[model samples]
Target chain A: MNIRYPNGTAYHQSAKRPATTMSQTTNYGDRGMSLEAELNESNQYYLNQGVAVIHKKPTPVQIVKVDYPKRSAATIKEAYFRQPSTTDYNGVYQGYYLDFDAKETKNKTSFPLKNFHAHQIAHLRACVAAGGIGFAIIRFTDDVATFLLPASFLFHCWDDALQTDGRKSIRRSAIEAHGYQINPALNPLVPYLNAVDQLITATKK
Target chain B: MNIRYPNGTAYHQSAKRPATTMSQTTNYGDRGMSLEAELNESNQYYLNQGVAVIHKKPTPVQIVKVDYPKRSAATIKEAYFRQPSTTDYNGVYQGYYLDFDAKETKNKTSFPLKNFHAHQIAHLRACVAAGGIGFAIIRFTDDVATFLLPASFLFHCWDDALQTDGRKSIRRSAIEAHGYQINPALNPLVPYLNAVDQLITATKK
Candidate 1:
């Protein structure tokens, strides 16, 4: 199960200096406004309206060596991924705990299984068991449609990895059937907060 | 009132790394453990014992410089806190969504106001309003005791920063009155999950 970027875009290796967007760094990945930036803007919108509380998790970077070039802006010349994070955002929306991962895939038909790691799958499983609403926001770039797939379905697919003839992706039809479709909006950009509102209302009943 | 660390050690900028029991690097202002390590470990423990599910967030690091002295190990020489983080940890324990900050202070009598940033306070406010169990764990190193103070309490103390002769720290009495005290165990370093159990039991009853 290999999740391939549009044009063989590998995991981005950050540079010493903040250059351009990931697309400019490498066009192979079909990268755009980083998911981090979009979520941040969305969070700001949530804050302004007093609607919901949502935030993107910070990437865990293990700092190794630092260079004091001028006493300001410590240059992290060496670092490593501390640990693979479980999800992208986890907070309270309305009156429930909202935890999810937002990911974009260039594939038109299915989301590649390689996009998620085993640890992340385990995390979602535990979160769901503990009663938090765990889900994933999968963006099918080809159709430009995003769907909120509950983590339970994702975990079941992940568990299938143990099977002999296991598949490698979640097809579009499956998402259409099980996931809550999300459309982008002006103020919040991702407009996921609205979906959260809907889910909360539905779940309460 | 500001909450102090156990030792009454006031927060002072680190001229050089203090040889304390830290993960890698930390400062007088910033608590160590990268938030990721702590959460990952906490998550692992959650999975093993079926306690809770929680994870730390990912943030984009504006990497200024990097030196690949060797192929295997890329050293980050420069990096900056890109955006203000919302909180340290958020997950579901039992049937409640929990959001909190895990902070360590060396002060014995009171915890300082400077330890928390403006954004964190704002984020906690939103989480609390949304009905999540939002609070913070303050470690007083001198007494080796960690207290779980509610976000409501935090809002009052932090907002008191400008009261002109305002109480800049949360006294031990206040924490004892309003916070859930956590005692670290061998398995979980922070053992906050236990405190959550107490909170859940009380809420359920």
Candidate 2:
């Protein structure tokens, strides 16, 4: 039977699709693949190299109905996405607790503040308060440029946006001034850890 | 349409069941509640009090089909469990990364090693290597006694079990000797963090 995803797109069952084929299908010249896919591949590379232990939290779903054909396996027949209360990814890296989310926008001039939710900002604030490193990986899809924006810098912009009639989105110039640029690599597509190392060094200073 | 769970129990659509009634029906006299439920409640308490920010990762499911009947809410029509590569819960607490799994067994004298998968053990080992705290909160269902067993001790037992003709499960006496016993309380319900505090102190030494 035909099915649909939450976004109203038709769900195509790609059970037999090879991993290499899926990666090859991305329009690399313009988009260079999705930010999420790049991060996942980079994380796998880091894991294989024994550099870090990071993982994306699974999407939260509320199961309403399930079917059991036998005793060993059960098939979920009804479920919906539950709003998540935390960031997308979190894990231990080089004896540090890292919490962050990745976002992509086709907008060339600025990264819109609407990409973040109040609850997620609150969570990042709490993480920082508890001494964990919190940051955002913002990707300007138009230029394939990504920046590791520290939570503190984001928080400042968020509060400023609320108090004044200023721009709600962070300008590209401001992000370049405050955030560290992450260079893409062959082995690890998005070498975010290098930006994280800079974050740690800056924190120490 | 009727459905069943992996345990062969029919899934009763409890859309209208009151929360209080569900908690009351758990046969609380002999067994207070499932270890998972108690931990979730305790985690909520911790969050409410600003004590810690720990959360259980949602159960992972591989969705094969989803139906949008009227183009509003999507219902999963076919999904199955995916083997989890990490522990059930992980979060940052007081600057430390904590990862653990809660397990319950009716066996009074020993906690079977079979309850843990090789992948989980490997994941825990990796977490420890990355400088995060890894552990198991084991509940002896018969006596309702729970202990915080360190992953280091668990690793030793796992390696020894494979190498020799030794008991595959940890003996009650051994756990009592090596693990920190967690006392349940009213507010936090599972008071496991106090045991965690002790674990942290010992790590410092």
Candidate 3:
């Protein structure tokens, strides 16, 4: 089935998987769905439960050309995806401003630093500075595991990687130690806010 | 000159103005620019000064068809605008979750309730219930007056208008009485944060 984004961009589930990996029938907590989709579901649950008000910002598109037809809706003839200056998701939860992005990696042992863009990192950093909670929900496609990594820790890793001899990726062990692992659940799929509560508590300290 | 939104939607300044009114030669604090543009500039100013981290969410587009040509950028062939689920602007300021939309009107005596969508009001209500600050930056194009009306008051107006005998619009007199007027400034254009500071103070009480 063809899944199109809000911007009409095609999304292929198979393309998201590592090229070398063979298709496995076994599903891990709704493994077929992308991390973003899962998170959206989770946010909807939260909204319905009156737990939070969060939403994924629409995909940013730079429209270049458009044609207006008589008595019909305008048609976009040319457009391009623009690099987002902020994260994919943000909203208010318990008076705290929540800002974050969802990323998935197929690596078994570690997550690569290249998954994050410099501007995204900067935007997260600025949000943190302004007293908002910033984080990244990283999913390991291999095991269908997800982790909520705080922006403060992410900044540390991002800056460390800038060093000449610094490591290019974060070890899975390090993430396990520093980040909050999000267990998948039925209602919210990702069940990320349980981990977010832990982040909020830590920030207060 | 043609201006395209991030979603490639054309924005015509002339179309925004009331057709019955004659275009005045004198400018009222950059009259030609849309309220969205002015607020964007203000948000940028706030971000730069480390006063706040706010942004206008991109225009939502429902993409119907796209063509990917080999060795060339993908072209969006067809797309339509989607009704946004939330307000256009939201961010963190001094640890407060701020959500708002900017609206402008040509009516001199009153601001029409019709200018706001039901979803936008509901979204703002949800945000307020979650302990976030919610408001609207209403602009009167006649004198280029801007005001920040708290979402609480907006809810009252919205609900009132729903009644059989209620007024269809909010009078400028009432807006002047309830809403905090925003003076146009050179640096930020819409220095609405000063009004937001008042909101924060009131919420604390």
Candidate with top lDDT is: 3
Cα lDDT computed for each candidate against the true fold? 0.71, 0.83, 0.86
RMSD, candidate 2, Å? 8.2
Give a tens-digit lDDT track for model 1, residues B1-205.
3433332333333344343622343333224343335446756787688887766555568766666775566656667757655776777887677788777777878899788888788778877777778888887765557777878788999888758988988888898887888765546656777776776666669
Question: What's the DockQ for every one of the candidates?
Answer: 0.45, 0.52, 0.63
Please give the range of 10 consecutive residues that has the lowest summed lDDT in model 3 chain A: A3-12
lDDT of 2 by residue, A1-205 (tens): 4432232122133455433334423334233367898899888888788888888888888988878887678888888878899999888888888999999998999999999999899889887887789999999876688999999999999897887786799999999999999977787999999999999999999
| Decoy 1 TM-score against native | 0.75
| Clash count, candidate 2 | 0
Best by DockQ: 3
lDDT of 3 at B38: 85
Write one digit per residue (lDDT tens) for candidate 1, span A1-205. Answer: 3333433253345433233333434432223556556678888788678877777676678866666678576566667766665676777776677778888898998998898877777778777787778888888865567888877678877778668888778888998887788777767777876666666666779
Candidate by candidate, in order, the iRMS in Å equals: 2.7, 1.2, 1.0
For B36-147, candidate 2 gives per-residue lDDT tens digits of 9889989988877777778899888898988878958777778888899789998888989898999998898999999999999988988899889999999887667889
- Candidate 1's C-alpha runs over 4 A off are A1-37, A68-71, A197-205, B1-44, B56-60, B65-77, B197-205
Ranking according to lDDT, highest score first: 3, 2, 1
Flag regions of model 2 displaced more than 4 Å. A1-32, B1-31, B69-71
Q: Rate residue B39 of model 1 by lDDT.
A: 44
